[model samples]
Target chain A: MAAQLKGARVALEVDNVTKRFGGLTALDHVSFKVYEGEILGLIGPNGAGKTTMFNVITGVYKPEEGRVIYYGEDITGLKPHVIARKGIARTHQVVKPFNELTVLENAMIGALFGTRHGQITEEEARSIAMEILEFVGLAEKAEEPAKVLNIQEKKRLELARALAEEPRLLLLDEVLAGLNPTEVAHMLDLLRKIRREKGVTMIMIEHVMHAVMNLADRIVVLHFGRKLAEGTPEEVARNPEVIAAYLGDPELALKFVRRLGGV
Target chain B: MNDTIRKLYTRPSALIAWGLVLIFVVVGVLFKAGLVSLNTATIAMDLMVNIGLALSLAIIMSYAGYVSFGHAVFYGLGGFLTGYIVYNAVQTAYTANPQNFNLTFGRALGWWLEGAVLGALASAALAGTVGAAVLRLRGAFFAIATIGLDYAVLYLVKLYHNPLSGSADIPVTQLGAIEGFFYKTYVLVTVFFIVTVIVAYLARVSKFGYGLSAIREDEDAAEVLGVDTTRYKVYAFILSAVLTSLWGSITVWRQNSFGVDIMFSLRESVHMIAMNVIGGLGSFLGPTLGGMVYYALYRATLTKLANSQFIVVGIIVILFISLLPEGLVGLVKLVRPKLRKYID
Candidate 1:
């Protein structure tokens, strides 16, 4: 997997990006590359600017300096919708489903307006939305209003929405955050299926160590608005600094490093 | 054909939209047949104006979730433009050939039609410009900005006198003096009303409408999901402004003259918003229904309550808002959830 990743094309590059909010620096010269068809896990302690990086990449927040290159083009500071049309899709940590719209309708918005938007007719969008809902295991709830969904289902809907956009690069923010072990396992399988079937490159920010550790081809650790470490899961698990960063948060510190001992 | 148009003809939105148009057609036909009294025909015309204005506001307010509190600016601008056109065109013709200054029915009709079309274009231009700026604001800020723009335009119109007329009032009474002018104006308004309904219905069911609905539900999320929020909003605003302006033009032609004070009044803006709120916010049918219900409420209370009719209307609007945020359409959905799909 590591050999293949090294040879794969670079799908996205965050080059020396610095984002500031008021006086405080949220991300300081943070930089990374997301390879094509690879799942790069972004793991960080709380307030480590994980989400801020996602925001910068997604064009929700413009970086004070540096560029977000997607598919060998500088796409920095474009509008969110423009970025979306450029084939970058993201899931919010706090899922934002169109509550009044049906689950199918919610997914349809992605297909109707996302990448290749004007080309896709309403009927085509509907079928695309239905196909996505099926993939996300939300087909049964397709006709129901999104507000009625449980947290897990809502997360799936978020993923479904992003997927329906046909994004080349998918940003998953805490997809497994509030799920139980079984649900997490199910989501992990779904993620694997997505990567395998769609071959879409993904950058997932997760606190669920075991899942990210097992799923990601490579891991990038962030700490206090800076890159703390980057390596394959085994290499990152063995890094003392990465372990030290996790030490402050005991729940992650134990599982994040210790769970990989047997590997 | 829009795939959104269901194969089954029983769709609630389709029924409501076409049914309202049919009513307008019937009234117009009866008026043409001379079976309806002028007073009754005028009342029907007034109802069409009110509903048309409400639906225009609904395109932006309900669908896109941009509550433009100063929507009457477009309405007044329409009237003012029509007045300006009629006064200028007729007066210019008279000056050019005063000896045979014959304001024939065809000439007068030509001026009024020109006024209506020009009014619509001017309104669309203004909305596109203003919406680009004001739509950047959300919620109350956007509403307040619209009100500010409304007053700014109103005061500007108040200050300026047509140099030709040498007065602020630009009377189009000559056009009204033409034979059968009232009935013709009524017919024009009815046609415009039908156009407004069709536009609103199309906006609700189109892919563009879905994008607006997504914006209404959650704007930031919608943008991230690839909806061009700014462009969609401006388009919806233009659609709304143009429709309102057409109504305004027709109305001023019927009234023969308009006062800037009343034309640009915030009261009209509030009424448009009230109608939409009373009916429902987002759906095309909601505002149409709301407009009718609002007009009915006004007529019902006008005789009994005298000057406090609006206060009564205000109380009713507050009741609807507090109890039914979704408005009349919501009430229907609640009663018959089965009918939700049938409705927009």
Candidate 2:
């Protein structure tokens, strides 16, 4: 289940990754291979260490025991910028936008530093940022300060900022967390368009079960910082342990399955 | 250079704002050429240097979002370096070796230039090392660390009695023409102020400037988005320090002597920070505007406003921080957002 990448290139390989916070074991021996041009869903209940997994992958926190291999190179213990420079980009669960900078400026920071090439002109960076903002439907609010954006727009701003990096792999942490249902649907369509059009590899930590079921190509479930289940949406939904750990009630599980267009 | 000038002039109100600043410098020069009393010239000189100091710190604080309460350490070091060099040169030609007299304008000018260059290098090196260590502390912690560093440096100077830095003033009295020195100081101060204004402007509009603002906005996000926060912070600290050191070195030349009290005064750091806060933290015109306004009030009061000038200044600052935290530039943007682009 772990090495099978559907005949696609492996973009990232998290091998036996373990993380700890004092006595708390945040992530323990989690292994996953993200293939090119596919969305890998990372799901779990509260205190399941979903965001910590993203943090470790993005170099925000180092895993105590294992390796984060990106494009066949070991990127463990690298700085966040160094990882970003190596085509790994991530958005925060809390949506950390640059409050004082304009929406476009927030995006340009990504284009300037996150891009694969070094030393781009400001004009080039601005145009690239503008394109990303347009793609995320945030072009209209380019001149406004990031602080002024609504939650959904801020979420889009985060997406645009990460997209501006031109990253080969994008790690999205709870992107659908605070969105309204309509916004979630709109975002789901947008994410599909991103994968379909850009051919990007993605690893997303989401609590929206139906959304993850509909969007992710493969599902990986975590319980108490360990891999509880991994498979297609149908297979994961049928796993009793995953259902008990995450879906909790059988009736709720049926409703979630129904919402994901049923399997 | 052409592009910078174009950017500076094409903005809606840049012409008027720059015109006002240039007019002030022109008027001071006119007064000096007219052989006005040294008192008026001295005050004008003081205004320019204070403006320079205020603008220098704005790059790190306003641009990069690192408040340095011990910023005067660079200024003091630069001043002391110049003082030491000048003292040795003067002592050798006049006292130690009178036969090898070289106190002419040409010789003295050469010495001052060498001193300024040395001062910049020393301050930049120290800032690089110290900023890397201290800048790891964010927000108020970084601010508090700087204050502690300032006090520590002050005490260290007080303890170690060097020819350049000590309780007693070091003599630098071999100037070929005292009047010539003051006039040159005025011009050099103007040049330095303009250069700093450009540096501060470039820091705001350039890609590097944007990266810095990103750090100021949210350091974690900046790093994740690919900004090397550690390296950029140190770069900004060194730039702020070098400019500050240059100002300090020139102050020594104009004043003819310096001591620990005046060279490393905590009061000077307060003035710089207070003026920047009052003007606008990150805006280029903010500190310049704040410097002029504060200087006018100080000069007009004639030391009659209070028992001590600092007490009055401190009270005013407290009011500013509480009531109008955005400062004058923020107030300007609030009233007329359209005009905001021109000032920066």
Candidate 3:
């Protein structure tokens, strides 16, 4: 990835963010900083509030306590579109594509209105969308209806649409969750390339440790809506608490360790 | 095949459509020539009114994924408002005991045109107001709210039977020349048709249209993508309502009166839904095609076999939903590709 940190500043700063849904606390005083041009992996077991954290960051759900500061501005509780305009974009856990619209048309919407008062000619938006599609290896499927895409392709299209917005901070929720090995490898390469080419900061909520460990500069783990650990991939993998948590599933932990390859 | 023929044959159904319109025009012209005093032209006019209703429904159904059964309320209100204005104008003109309510070319043109304009404005206002409240509901709730509104309006119209201001029938002593009256009605219908076409076109092309389609496809996703769902829904409802009201006003003008029976009838609501479905809900040309076909069938078959007309219509609607959910246009799309392969 390109390390051209021109005007390199904090891309996102979440100061004690908390979210509660009825009786269940989805997030509890979560705090993190995403540096410009860095990939941050957020991982936890199921019901660990990883997706909820993403929702709060992307303005889908407002944090009950604390603020979400993006690029030095307090953007807490802004509508999703308003936050999107401020250069924060996100993909959903369950891929949501406009089914009736062609893939290109869906991406075009992102390019046209992604930023606040940002206007681009239709031709320009189309070219940008096409380029993003190529980056995601979906150039061939640009004219097809988004509904007809396979799961992997739909996930890629969601990412491509977010990229079209030229977001400085991109929040990706479980993008590699359902992908096959080859598809997962391709997505990892694409994320690396995106960070290199666009200098976009990304916070990825991932279940696949191998995919995220290799990509994220820093890794944060959560359990029951509270921060469990935050450190380099090597430190996190060796943490006794993390190992005990994964001990119940010996197969997954063994596989993760093997994939880490002596890290 | 040359470009024109290739384009024409590419859409075989469209070609058949043009052929049908041509046949209707020929029949209308022949009837006007006195070979037949066929009431088909009047029926065709009514079909055009139904087309307007279907077109409005299409905006909600196809574009917004909202199904409304109470659109008849707007249609009836439109007709009633138009009837109220034109009838009052005629009464004003004849109170001085003019020989005929019909004005000469020089005077009648301006007065009739003014009445048409006023009627359109009134209908549009009412539609916008009602659309605001009713559009907030979705799914069955939205549909029921609209139906409730329709019944409410029907009862309100029923309650008022005053001869001068609120009654269903307002007789005009001096209705201008027959030629001028028919000509004005034709103009109003044409204007409403053009407006419907323009609204459909805009909805198909504009950002607002895309937003509406996105909402229809997935509301939560659209919101996450920064689309304001509520605002777009209201806009779609108002625009659809205005077009429907324009059609309603013209219907009232044609009858020179309005009543609860005509405005809020359940049959009228069914006609609107049927027109949209038979035409191809959501497709731009669906409502128009459905309206024309249904009207023709109603005139040719229903008029002769009055009771069975509805049964036949019911059967056709059932077939459309079960056999061809995409409606007539969908059927054409299925056939055209196969036919082209054979030709090739």
The lDDT values for all models are 0.87, 0.82, 0.72
All candidates: TM-score: 0.94, 0.93, 0.85
TM-score of 1: 0.94
What tier of docking accuracy does candidate 2 attain? medium
Which candidate model has the greater lDDT, 1 or 3? Answer: 1
Candidate 1: the clashing residue pairs are none
Chain A TM-score of model 3 comes to 0.91
Question: Clashes in model 2: which pairs?
Answer: none
Summing lDDT over every window of 10 consecutive residues in candidate 2 chain B, give the lowest-scoring window.
B161-170
What C-alpha RMSD separates each model from the true structure?
2.4, 2.7, 5.0
User: Model 2 off-target regions past 4 Å?
Assistant: A1-5, A261-263, B1-21, B35-43, B96-102, B162-168, B173-179
The alpha-carbon lDDT assigned to residue B212 of candidate 1 equals 96
**Model 3 residue A222 lDDT?**
89
Computed on C-alpha atoms, the DockQ of candidate 2 is: 0.66
Residue-level error in angstroms, candidate 2, position A79: 0.7
Residue ranges of candidate 3 with Cα displaced over 4 Å? A1-7, A116-118, A246-263, B1-40, B96-130, B160-179, B337-344
Q: Which of 2 and 3 is ahead in TM-score?
A: 2
Tens-place lDDT digits, model 2, residues B150-262? 67776776677565443545668666254366666667777776777677666666667777888888999999989998999999899999999998888888777766677
lDDT tens digits by residue: candidate 3, B1-344 = 13223433454434543454455455555655766454656665566666667777778776787777887877777666566666666667778667755565445435545655664565556556776777777789988888888888778866775666655655432443455565455545655555665566456445666678778877777766767777778778777776776676666556655665767777777887887787765555667677777777677776677888788878888998888886776565468733421210
Candidate 2 displacement at residue B156 in angstroms? 2.8
